[model samples]
Target: MNQLPTAPPVATAQVPPHLVDSTSRYVESGLRGAANTVRAYAGDWKRFNAWCTLNHLSALPASVEALAGFLTELADAGKKVATIQRHAAAITKAHELAGHDSPTADKKIKVLLKGIAREKKTRIKQAAAFTLATFKRTIQSMDVTTPTGLRNRALLLLGFTGAFRRSELEALNLEDLAFDEEGLIISLGKSKTNQLGQAEEKAIFYSPDSAVCPIRSLQAWLRVLGRTEGPIFVSLRKNQQLTARRMTTKYINLITQQYLGSGYTAHSLRASFVTVSKLNGADDSKVMNQTKHKTSAMIRRYTRLDNVRQHNSAKELGL
Candidate 1:
């Protein structure tokens, strides 16, 4: 709703001697997070500020009672636990920027959130992950002769094997890739998880099957691209002419849904990577190496083995 500036002029408000140091610390760490997170904070804070205005309450220096009530309202409005939690974080960021003590630290706010999470189930809907069989089948159905088709094939294959987020797929440039004997190496400067812009690389090995191979598909697309350096994926005109404009993250979602059926989201590419890898007996460490997740817990979370019969040790035990 609101796009608050990531950085603002320092608040020159008077503060007590005891709080001055803590206030400075908060200011230094104000609103630091991943790009998507920061944007969410800005929008959520704007919505909170609007709500406070309607209720004639001060948004800045929010009281514990006010913060609790706002959070409760979000829950009542059917917002998921994750959304409510993010909203609270946004409010905290707002307070930090203003150099005010965040009411979110209060026990009342914390307990209120706990109660809301319990009352409303905390399980948010994850994207539906497809089997590798389905992935290959979908890839086979595409007509890569067209420029648009080639682009989609490259993105989908690369995204799945590399375990790339939609944002990362959209951010890919020609220079971000390096080809060698083994396969292609994708260099990522920044990503949803790797927000610090650390130098991260994901190795994509050549697939024995050239039809659904990421490296081969990418190379084929590049040959048609005829450009030394530029955005890898771009919008194409009706006549199959590629434009300088880059493909939007939303387009990535549409392309996935277009090929993989309406049931799957763009994230299915990455989620399926984890699910299929784990299904194939890949350990958490190996999956983490590809996904770049800091913890094994996250890799487990991304795994979509809904059927209890599959990957279960129950059947292996002596009955």
Candidate 2:
């Protein structure tokens, strides 16, 4: 009697054509989320397929045992729970699309997640609330005699005035800024104001004409630097000639480290700006526009006014 032959291993690229077409459509939706999300899911699925092939597991759709094995391997590799969960989600989505009800869908996923716990660590406090009253004095102490010093002073002024993220400050182009009769209109494509979750993409706008006079210093630096176009912040050599390239985020970090030490960050100016604005009674809508925040929740974190205002009121009443 002839023995039955073992089934050949399935090819990943042999996935149903309709599923591939649907995934393609999902990726090209033009939404910002679609691009990253679809790419991540597709990549995770490919990795899972490879793992299944190596383990000699039948990469059958919805196989809870195979999924459990995959999770075990991920844990052995020291993958974080969040990372494993993301991979599991992608696998489940793919399996469902292939018309195979995922055996690991709800039950096995819950069990796997239970094994992958969140890391426990102290959360670092934001540097915003620790406003040293001597920040201005520190700036005054900085030497402005040299070309590099002058540029550093200008950078400091812009950071405080514009509340720019280091990346946004680095990305600044000469064409993005306009010096008008009122003040400077900086076209900030990205900013600390945008935060991590804002949906709208409006650029942050900063004008030097505010009560702060240091905005003029930025203008002076711009004029003296002789940069009429291209990047607004250019690297300067020892000879004081402007380098064609722009400054980088790492350079900004270095400036912060050298000037303000450990507690200070590029984000400090942003927080300080928000605190100052709220203290001056600037409305949420105006602050929102300046910060380019789609919502008010993020701005609220920087405006810790309840206790500060109450303390001042008690002082006024001599209580």
Candidate 3:
């Protein structure tokens, strides 16, 4: 009988050190992911590494079972489901890059997303829409005689009139503003955009007319404040010199909180602008274009039909 020959012993495989280093460098340089996204993933990976180290487990080249265990640990520690999902997402992305498939990726992501939705439903208090009347009240309540107060008022007007996000407002430089025959044009450098999620790199121009109330308020503010150059809004110290330093997102939040009390957030200003423009018969597509919103779904989040306009429409329709 022709019996099968004895099977040869398997040899241990070894990957070269230089090959590993080269592969890492290639990933660091040439990965198609955005820089910010990579940074976030790196941060997540570090946290995972730390957790695994504390528990005497290996974090590198994590397996589906290890990931599931980690998520279970997170759940036990009362960590938010969103946070767990983020960690899972980072691991999944890393594994995909390493040409490996993760069995838990879809399941973990789905569970986390469901948890996020449930949490959101529990916190369903949306921001109340801002109105022209409420805006005037807020401005009037401010003690604009003080330099800081005056600057804040101007900032508020700019934020509302230009539909500026906190980041966009903070990034504005004095050179970005242009005085032309049409009106005042403030150049916006960055804001949240659907096209890129956030931090869009292009500059957009926002025009505020002297004839309009919001624009007129801004013009009056610019005239009273005498701030035409340098960083448009500088931090005002007790000495009253406009510091070379720029304003921050936190300052925007504080200022809005101070003026509007609890329900009025800085983002409400931008939303109000979009809502008012839509109620005034401005085209949604044009408004979306100006706001740099790539989708109608997101534009709806920022734009709502004005209550007064809705009432008037109802009356006209005999409803």
Candidate 4:
């Protein structure tokens, strides 16, 4: 294969030092994947490397048998099927980086994964969807007079209305927001699906009740922030003074649980958005527009239609 200046040498069998050096730069520059994806692979690869060391097997250019053994043991030890799949993906990525054929490509390895998945069910418990009544009740319960209350109220409302992932919400800044006569416009810089850095916008409107309006809640929070730039949702110090540091995803989960009680994560905000919106007759295309989902399949996955009475076509059959 002809080698591009940016790619590793293929014809010479041995890559030149100069070509390898340039390739290394792109590898470290997140050209291969997202920052979080890279970090996850790095962590999974580290554990695999350690396992190989303990078993005296070469992690790089790993044998199919060795890789299979490592994965089978992890499954036996009760690692979820999703996690096991990630470990395999990490191994494949590491092999590709080292210019070696990945052992994970073997048919035996694929069959093994399938067998393990069949033996161990792949069902995942999703976040519970909170209804509009429950959502209104919860928001009203929050005392928004205090700075902390304002921040939390804005975080929850905006998060739900925008259908934002906690990671996306945590990275939000005041500069990303645009306020106008209509409502609020958010210039989302990058998202999990929007990795190529295309321009993306999410619009939210005013609610009849000022208390539940995401725009008004966000504006109230901004008034407390006293600054137009920098991180919007920030960490609060002991005395409730805002810190410049951005909030973490874990804290977002904790905050969601704190307000909504157990059985909900920060993901519930996004899930409920899909559930409630779909129940309210928003079509797949419209929901996909706000959710930034490229496919209807994923929108279906995010929807938590647990209620027997909600969204049932059986009831509408006029029996």
Candidate 5:
């Protein structure tokens, strides 16, 4: 009888140790929160780890005293109170993930944070809103002849009208846009408020004037781009040719600053929307629909700087 042919040995695939380690870190980071939040927490944890390594201490189960000392050193180094607080929160999260009690809750750590806040007089510097006049001037300054100009004009107009955060603006894709008789509808896949990947829609109504209309600007940009899919905003080469890569939030800030001058950031678009809308008599709930703000408190905060004088009871009292 003929013997059966010997079976060929099957090859076993082997994954490198480093890749496994990296994948674990990626998964852990994903579990924590949004990509930006994960990046920030990772950075904070790295700093804490470095400090521990320099002082010959264990970072995994850092002692309360050690954490307190770290905060003290950060304060002494002139780190912002908010920065220190974020660092402490990162450390606490790490310990919790490792199945250890959070050292950040120690009385000493709390006391140190309180002292730093008191010393620093921690006040958040809000981004100044771009008034309608300033926004119009900036738009007029843009040269829509070139691809970069068209993209920038569209970005600024859409960002302002939609009240989008920098990340939201940058995250936009061609698929997110839908045009109707009224104007355009943008579907936000995820945002700071909708972290669970829920779908949210923002409508951009058409303007009778073509000069300052976001919908028209966006249409012009898409027509020039000549593509049906992919990132809405991308980097432009020195020759003004569009690149396939998507732009970052940092770039958005730089672009806004470039056109609007100093003291304005990417957030200024959102703030300007809130301020202008409130000044135009749009109430909190109405603004919330455009901004996707979960609470009236945040809406008030955005409009507070501009509306303080207008909304004050003192004005009604003729003081």
Candidate 6:
């Protein structure tokens, strides 16, 4: 009787006890946020660790003075107040994960941050919203005859209509799309707000005009893709050949900049959705329904320009 040969057993490498514990805690902490957030926190922690090492200071149980010195160095290097604050938060989170008290919680650190905020007069830059006219112009400018063009057109339309964050857009897969007579439905497995992996759906209705319809654009792109699985948007080689990889969030920002010029980011599509919806007379709650904004305050911030002009008391006074 003939028998198949047995394969050799694979050997597993043993991790050090300290490394095992540290890795477990780091992973557990990372699981609490979205992937991008985890990456940002990891980078922030690495920078802090590097700083502590260079200055011969303790990082795991960092002192308030050391943390304050790090912030001071960041400010001296022209880091924004928001960037410094986020770094502080990352440091705090890292220490807590290691079972130590966060130095960022000290009164001195808080006061230092406040003083930095008061010292810096830099304004936070917001992405420019795409109005209806600008949206139409941008869409029309895309030549959908080529493969990349088709993909960009579809990406832009879906992003604007769905009001999806850059991460959400890049996370979309072919399985997430559902098409029907009404329009297209996108099933988001996870998002910034839904870190529990809860399923959520966003609808994009068909437009009367085929040229500006997101559904039509998506269909055209899919036809070019010729696949029923994998990511919806993919990386294109220099020759315009589609790769079997998902697009990065940075690419989304670049695409927006390509169409709308500089200062526009991937968030422009989402902000545009909220701004245009309000300008078209949609209420805050209605816009919030589409945007999935957690608070009315955020929705208000998006529509502030429209509100200031529409609800201006000056219009009521006989000027």
How accurate locally is residue 310 in candidate 5, as Cα lDDT from 0 to 100? 53
TM-score-superior candidate, 1 or 4: 4
Model 2 scores a C-alpha lDDT of 0.63
- In model 2, the number of clashes is 1
* Candidate 4: tens digits of C-alpha lDDT, residues 1-319: 0111122334434667568766566664443466567677888888888888899998887899999999999999999988999999988877776667899999999999999999997765678889989999999999987899999999999999999988899889989998999998899877788887799999999999998999999999999999979999999997999889999888989999999998899999999999999989999999988889999999999988878888788987877
Residue 272, model 2: lDDT of: 71
lDDT of 1 by residue, 97-172 (tens): 6657899999888899889988986777799999888889989989988989998999999999999998888888
List the candidates ranked by lDDT, beginning with the highest. 4, 1, 5, 6, 3, 2
TM-score for all models, in order of appearance: 0.87, 0.59, 0.66, 0.88, 0.86, 0.87
Clashing pairs in 3: none
Candidate 4 lDDT at 286 equals 96
Please give the TM-score that candidate 3 achieves against the real structure.
0.66
Specify the highest-TM-score model's number: 4
Q: Give Cα distance to truth, residue 58, candidate 2, Å.
A: 15
Worst 10 residues of 2 by lDDT: 1-10
Give me the runs in candidate 3 sitting further than 4 Å from their true place.
Answer: 1-53, 56-104, 119-128, 194-229, 304-319
Instruction: For candidate 2, write residues 83-160 as lDDT tens digits.
Output: 777788777656544546665656756766675553422233465432434456667777877767777877876776
Q: Where in model 1 is the C-alpha error above 4 Å? A: 5-30
Per-residue C-alpha lDDT of model 6 across residues 206-268, encoded as one tens digit per residue: 999888999999999999899999999999998989899899999988998998888688998
lDDT value, residue 27 of candidate 4? 60
The residue ranges of model 4 lying beyond 4 angstroms of the native Cα positions read 1-31
The TM-score of candidate 2 is: 0.59
- Cα lDDT tens digits, model 3, 3-24, are 1111222222454654765555
